[model samples]
Target: MTETVRIATLDGADSFDAYVAWPEGTPRAAIIVIQEIFGVNPGIRAKCDKWAAAGYLAVAPDLFWRIERGIELDPDVEPEMQRAFELFGLNKPDDNVKDIEATIHWIRREAGVPKVGAVGYCLGGKLAYMTATRTDIDASVGYYGVMIDQMLGESHAIAKPLLLHVPTADHFVDAEAQAKMHEGLDGHPRVTIHDYEGLDHGFATESGNRRDEAGAQLADSRTAEFFAANL
Candidate 1:
């Protein structure tokens, strides 16, 4: 079952609504499902429900609320993509982390679960890495996170379990950039990197021309196992 709820921000001056899914009986852990450049749309809400079906108390926060509440954009549309990027640029990493932290706090208090984990895609994927290093979450899974090569310096800060799913053909991250990420992050004791060959960015979205059902299933199953063991 699922419902809409508001999580208080750090300053308490603002609150954002999130779609929360609850498993039957008590939850084994809490999973925070971060969104792509799009807001908390049907896809992200479906992800929260999927996690809940896996026995987790899951929530997907509307990270775009501060900029434009309830915005849902189609990935294939050029105008929507441009607008998404514009809104994405308006956010700083620190502010995004604060909202994620607020979501974690809400889960810890409301779910009555001791463990929390995070899974994010696209823009949310980068945020998942930040969540692992900057927050107290038990585990994190990032699916083809953009700009990770730029943030490789923080890989050493991760003390908890982390899984990064990389698609070899992703336009956002090319071969040279992937090499940099491999050099900086692969074989780190706490990090697990999975590379998907012949796949593009947002392969897990199950929509448009980018969707790869096999790849998405493989990555998501790995994520479920990761959260199951770590969270």
Candidate 2:
């Protein structure tokens, strides 16, 4: 089942909306589903549903609410793609982490969930890395995350398990950045990096022009295993 939940920001100034999917039975754990440049749209909601079917409570917050609430964009649409980037530029990463932390606290304090992990995609994939470094998230998984190479200095703060999926041919993330990511995070005990050769970005999106069944299945299975072992 799915529902809308409101989470008060850490500062108690205002609240943001989060789409939540509940499992049929009591949850084994909870996972925060971070969105891409898009907001909490169908693709992200479907991801939550999948996790719910697997017996985890999944919550996806509207990270873009501060700029414009309820945004659902299409990458195939040129104008929307450009707008998505605009929103990305305006969104605050540090502030987003606080909201994520608040979500974690809400799950633990209200729902009594012992372990709370996060899985993010696209821009969210990069936030997953930030979550690992900045928040107390139990575990994190990121797919085709961009600009991660730029944040290598913060890797020292990653205290929990983090799994990153990198698409080698991703136009958004170039070759040099990929190399730097491997070089920076290779030996980190809490980090695992997987490379998908020749695949472009969004290969694992639930449904879209971008989805690649084989790559999605492989990466998702790895994510499930990683969460099971870590969370």
Candidate 3:
């Protein structure tokens, strides 16, 4: 079943809503689903539900709550995309990491799940990578993260398993950036990188015209296996 819950931030200065889904019985693990620039929309919620059906306790925190709660934006809408970017700019990377840290704390306080990990898409993808280098999560998966090349310096800080899904054709991550990322993370024992040859940015987003269903399925299956093994 799925429900909405309020969780406090690291400083407890404010609380944000997180869409949560639970497995039939006790969860084998817990997964934090970070949102794209679109916020906690249907896609993010569906991801949580799918994870729950797979026997993990899943939660997607409202990262955009500090700007506006319950934000559901369409990528095709220029104004909405603009708003998403505006909010993105205002929320520092450190802030996002703190919210995720608080989420980890909240989950540990409220649930008895054996392990916790995270999976993120688009903007959340970068957050997931940051989570790996900064937080205490067991594992993390990032789907075509942006500006990850710049953060590769922290790759050595990753003590937990990390999986990265990169679409070769993604405009946000050009060949140069991808090459840099691969150079930094490819041979690391704890890191796994998968590249889809011709997929575009947001290719895993079910609603986008650029979505590559087959690729998404394959990446998702790999993610499931990675989480099952590491978490």
Candidate 4:
């Protein structure tokens, strides 16, 4: 089951709307699932449910709550894509990090989990990387994050285990950016980067046409392994 919950931030703002899901027993770990530019839609909700079933206290927050609540995109439509870009472009990465931080705090305290992990996709993937650097999460996984190159310069400060899943044919993130990410992660003992060939962005979203079952399975296996090892 899921419940809408509110969380307070370091900036003295009450600005997060989150969907919290827990397993039948005490959670072994907690996870903060961040959303894509499409907001907290069915795909993200499914991810939260999946994590909870995997024995985690999973929570997915509507990161766009600062701008609008429940603003989701129809991935099959170009107009909806354009509108999503327009709305998301109005917010900066810092704003997204604040919301993520608030969600993390709630997961650790209110969710009653001893340790926490995070997983994100697309824009949420970038936020996952930022969350690792800026928060005290035990582990973080980012899938096809477009802004990874932009954040590479700050990766040295990351102290937790970070797993990045890249699609070889992603339109938004190219080969050169993947090379930059590798270089940024160089010598970081806790960082693992994997590239799946013939996969595109949104490979794990079952509702999207780009979803590749094989790629998503591999990513999910690797992500679970990473979280098991780290969290």
Considering every candidate listed, which one attains the maximal TM-score? 2
TM-score of 2: 0.98
Clashing pairs in 4: none
Tens digits of lDDT, candidate 2, 67-159: 988899888789988999999999998888888988998899977888999999998999999999999899999999989999999999999
Q: What lDDT, from 0 to 1, does candidate 1 have?
A: 0.89
Name the weakest run of 10 consecutive residues (lDDT summed) in model 2.
Answer: 105-114
TM-scores, all candidates, are: 0.96, 0.98, 0.96, 0.96
Q: Between prediction 1 and prediction 3, which has the larger lDDT?
A: 3
- Scored against the true structure, residue 179 in model 1 reaches a CA lDDT of 96
lDDT (0 to 1) per candidate: 0.89, 0.93, 0.91, 0.85
User: Which digits, one per residue and each the tens of the lDDT, describe model 1 over residues 1-231?
Assistant: 889998899898999988999999899999999899977877888888888888899999888887878888877889988988898889677788899999888888866788999999998989999998899899999999989889888887899999999999999999998999899888799999999999999999846767899999999899988988898
Q: Clash pairs of candidate 3?
A: none
Best candidate (score: lDDT)? 2
Deviation from native of the Cα of residue 96 in model 4, angstroms: 1.1
Per-residue alpha-carbon lDDT of candidate 4 for residues 1-85, written as tens digits (9 for 90 to 100): 6777877766864666788887878888998998988888888888989888989889988888778877878777899889888
Better of 1 and 2 by TM-score: 2
Name the runs in model 4 displaced over 4 angstroms. Answer: none
Per-residue lDDT of 78-152 in model 3, one digit per residue for the tens?
A: 898898888788777787889999889888888766589999998999999999999999999999999999998
